[model samples]
Target: MRLFFHTISARKKLVFLLALLVLPGGCSRHKSPRYLYGSNCGICHHGGEGMAGSVPPLSGRIDRIAATPEGRVYLASVLMNGVSGPIRAAGVPYRAEMPLFRYLSDEEAATILSWLSQQGETKPAPTITREDIAAARAHRISAGDVADMRAKLDLKHPLP
Candidate 1:
């Protein structure tokens, strides 16, 4: 009886461990926006401050870009499709190829964008919803096309 009880306890422990490993958002910060940003965007953006002359800063710029409907759409499109070629951000020119994050789920993408929008010096951060990401996904375009869209947006702080 003692041996049987010990075996049952061991099985219970194994099951609990497996549950923690397999359950969604369980014992894992992967679903958190900060973690997502760190693993995905942070590599280049470097805490959203960017790497001067190489990667454009996202801190102050992201909020301003998200201020308008068109800007919001552009942001969603950029996140889904990525962007390339020469572009101006924060009045500085950068020519880098941002990788497409199409693998990210709508919820994860939205969360990351929304979290990023809240970063920097801007107050009253803009929200990027899953619907926004879904809409961008519906109209699939190339990364280069996303850069073109960025040029056309009438943002408060225009991206040249």
Candidate 2:
């Protein structure tokens, strides 16, 4: 009887451990960053590699840009407003335009940005808050200027 009880307890512990490992963020019901990215960004970014001469790949790039003050503003503006016209993303020229994501609330935008910064990363990336998004929102830069903002910065990798 003792051995049987111990075996059951061990099995239960193993099951619980497996459960924790499987869930992306400890099994919360809230939508995951991956899910949000898939719904909102995947069609354009396409597994973060993006389509050639069109959408820019985001997985390895956003956070590096976000780390800077001016870059932060540009990134925020790009997310909030949409960019159009000729642009180079990660060194590739993309004539396609990016549409505004103004529909996303500040919180949702933060979530998306946070996710973008951490793609393919093993650990969590630095978090961007709704307040950060709000501050960028305050700038109210136009979509055209936001797209143009890219010209000012030296992007290590360009987005198409």
Candidate 3:
């Protein structure tokens, strides 16, 4: 009888400890998609004369990026490698020259992309994959692509 009670108590203690370990990660503030964006992308993307006019608003961009193959390609590439010119999301142009974060992990990029896609805006969500980031990184991203994208929006500073 005592052995049975000890066994059950031990199981309960193990279960409790496991829950304690996992719960913090589940409830973490930065784990949230919105919070992640606000921390990372929002650094350069949030509004201002410098950012508002320069950065395309993220709130309504999912639909635009999902509208066509070219848009998705451009969107993913821009996030992976970064851009130096005007960018237009959903026909609305933003002039900020987004720089590359070459060190962002693939999982982090995917999380941000998935968050942007499901943001519940007019544009359909994009189906960006880890493979896409890998491919973008492998390719020779060009200055011309940047110039073309820049032409689509108004920028705060003139391109050098």
For TM-score, the strongest prediction is 1
Off by over 4 Å in 3: 1-30, 47-50, 87-93, 122-124, 147-160
* 41-79 per-residue lDDT for model 1 (tens digits): 999998888999999988877777787788889999988
Better of 1 and 2 by TM-score: 1
**Candidate 3: tens digits of C-alpha lDDT, residues 45-101:** 762112545566666555445455555555667776677755554455665567775
Query: By descending lDDT, how would the candidates be arranged?
Result: 1, 2, 3
Query: Quick one: best lDDT, which candidate?
Result: 1
lDDT, candidate 2, equals: 0.72
Ranking by TM-score: 1, 2, 3
Off by over 4 Å in 1: 1-5, 9-13, 24-30, 154-157
The predicted structure with the larger TM-score, 1 or 3, is 1
- Give per-residue CA lDDT, model 2, range 51-71, as digits (tens): 876677786778777666666
State candidate 1's TM-score: 0.84
Give TM per candidate: 0.84, 0.70, 0.61
RMSD of each: 3.3, 8.2, 7.2
